[model samples]
Target: MNESIHVVCTHCHAMNRVPELRVGDAPSCGRCQQPLFQGQPVALDSAHFDKHLKGDLPLVVDFWAPWCGPCKSMAPQFAAAAQQLEPQIRLAKVDTEAEQALGARFGIRSIPTMVLFRGGQELARKSGALATRDIVAWARSVIK
Candidate 1:
């Protein structure tokens, strides 16, 4: 089995090597040395969104905006889900406010929408906020 998995840095856009067997282990960016899970979602934009989605990894993208109450409410839940699902899934966030083109391309009609992608293909997507348990279960169901 592979001991490590590759993850692109959400901040600096650098690739990282994290131990696949140690999902609970806190990993830092080898280039930026920042905590991979810092209690805040990793912000994404069109600049690197396609690369992340198309990578050989499972990714969860939250389409959110600062003004959306439901989106704000779901932020922590998404973060918790990421901590639990690490080493298996990559967590990402796209600010619909900032990335209008991306939001339009994804046809995001509502805030707090969640999309799961694997190998560049969208696996599942849903609108509204979900609990951590539900998010994990949903992701597990779609994971190959």
Candidate 2:
């Protein structure tokens, strides 16, 4: 059997065993059959945040609230970026209203903030909504 990484499906919260080497490839949830990177961000509760921070791979989290205009506006672009960047990065979302603790710990004072983390450390963060290209560019720059 090949060693694999356990990726938590953001859609159904199922654990997916993905080939370790294919972390950058387009992957789908085994049970849900949904694209792991459907391009839209995955909602991350506090538990999910904690679990993924401990992961060895890089993580991209979008902290947004549903009611925020900018957040809603950027949704499609964010999703597109997630879809294109799957496998190489894990995309997640933290609903500021739902995950209050996470928002505070991360010092999020605004909506539509994005943070890139690796090995439990924050590599970079940006506030305000951004386009899909900008999102991918930022992640790529910081992850390198």
Candidate 3:
């Protein structure tokens, strides 16, 4: 029997069971018919964030704000990290300016904080802006 993994749809927030072997085969969400891994970070609001946190796949979230210089500088690096981490990890972004409640909930006292979650539980967190290589390395080290 083939093992399966659960991935949350970035477009619809629906849970999908993808066979582990086919994870890199360009899987699509069953409900939304959207590509599951888009090689870019998904912009998530509070509601969608909660749903994605409960998924089986690890979620790496960049908590940032438009007004924050460091956050703005790290945006492209985060996007590049997403490209390198997709299919195995789901990368997401939360705008602290737009989702004040989420920032309060997560106790985000600073911008450019990256939080890693698995099965709705926080596994690790890092504060400050990181380059693409550092982001990828840190995420992989923590998840492993």
Choose the strongest candidate by TM-score.
3
lDDT of each: 0.82, 0.82, 0.93
**Tens-digit lDDT string for candidate 1 (17-104):** 6777654576788899976654445688999998676555688899999999999888899999987776568788999999999999
Q: After superposition, how far is residue 25 of candidate 1 from its true place, in Å?
A: 6.3
User: Clashes in model 1: which pairs?
Assistant: none
The reply for model 3, stretches above 4 Å from the true place, is: none
> Candidate 2 on 39-139: residue-level lDDT in tens?
55677787667776765558999999988999999888888898778767878888999888999999999989999998889999999989999999999
Candidate 3 global CA lDDT score: 0.93
Most accurate candidate by lDDT? 3
Model 2 residue 138 lDDT score: 95
Model 1 lDDT at residue 77:
94
Model 3 lDDT-worst window of ten: 48-57
The per-residue C-alpha lDDT of model 3 at residue 132 equals 99
- lDDT-superior candidate, 1 or 3: 3
Better-scoring candidate (TM-score), 2 or 3: 3
Best to worst by TM-score, what's the order? 3, 1, 2
lDDT by residue for model 3 (35-80), tens = 9999999999988888898787899999999999999999999999
